[model samples]
Target: MLGRVNHIAIAVPILEEAAAIYRDTLGAKVSEPQSLPKHGVTVIFVELPNTKIELLEPLDDASPIAAFLERNPSGGIHHICYETPDILSAAEKLSAAGARILGDGKPKIGAHGKPVLFLHPKDFNGTLIELEEV
Candidate 1:
């Protein structure tokens, strides 16, 4: 079962501009910029009382997030990462339940170097979902 919501990651063409909207208009304070060259995306965390919002933008065209933005031009919510106690078990259940996994069984290092896996949008009512251990 899906546990807590880890964070909502939004895909943007420009992380700074998107971050500004949360900081300027919404008044959500943001963290320092962090670039994950491995993932080819740069992320900025918007801190809130309850949860955080991660604004992610591609560093290059080869970035998977870049591909996601091109396919979904609206570019709002990219993925919902749910916190799980056991990532492997969670991913197994998802696969057994017929959810197509985008990244296979391996858990790649995600934000903060935590293990993460991706489930295709088709399996989640067209919403991309990620599983991460808390």
Candidate 2:
């Protein structure tokens, strides 16, 4: 049902600065910024040896990251993504187990162009969980 950790997403006020910090300060390989309108975020991935770190910025005022920034100001960890061999089955199992899925309870295209679904934070000890199809 669950695989390796996919990526850790961090919401930031500025995408470029966050990406630069990873690239220059941490000496990491960073990918180009991509706007995910459906998710209302512009993201850049810092490619690491074992996993990636996603830096996300709000695409608009209505973006969820914008709301997160309002509370955090400095921004913070947005979500942790985990790879899943079968998202639909995983969703079913999670649902049956009383875990609430966010949004319409359907998988959407993620940053890697894979099917992804988000679980509610309350169900996961205040941490938002993202399941991405492997």
Candidate 3:
């Protein structure tokens, strides 16, 4: 049901600073910031040979990432995304297996403009899992 690891997301207090670290200090190719209003985050992707690293900053106080930042203050790993060949089928299988899906239990358009669904962290060893249809 899962393909390769898509991208690991890191919630940050400031998007520009985080992107700078990856771009300047690490010498990574960071993509331009993209605002995802539906997800309530502004993200920038650090390109790598194998996988990408997503830096997320809360779009507003109501954003889930804002809550995460409040808890950590310094920010931290938010979620890990995995590629799935068929998100609907994967969601159905996960649901039948008793894994809870976040939100309305439906896929949303992700950063890559692909269908994505988030599973409960409790069901995945305290790590939020994002399934993105590849």
TM-score each candidate: 0.91, 0.94, 0.94
The Cα local distance difference test for each model comes to 0.84, 0.92, 0.94
Model 2, range 1-134, lDDT digits (tens) per residue?
87999999999999999998998998999999999998799999998889989999999999988999999988899999999999999989999998999989888887678999999999999999999998
Evaluated at residue 82, the lDDT of candidate 2 is: 94
TM value for model 1 = 0.91
Cα lDDT tens digits, model 3, 5-76, are 999999999999999999999999999999989879999999999999999999999999999999999999
Between prediction 2 and prediction 3, the one with superior lDDT is 3
Per-model C-alpha RMSD: 1.5, 1.2, 1.2
The true-versus-predicted C-alpha distance at residue 109 of model 2, in Å, is: 2.6
* lDDT-best of 1 and 3: 3
Q: Pairs clashing in candidate 1? A: none
Clashing residue pairs in candidate 3 (N, C-alpha, C atoms within 3 angstroms): none
- Segments in model 3 whose C-alpha atoms lie over 4 Å from true places: none
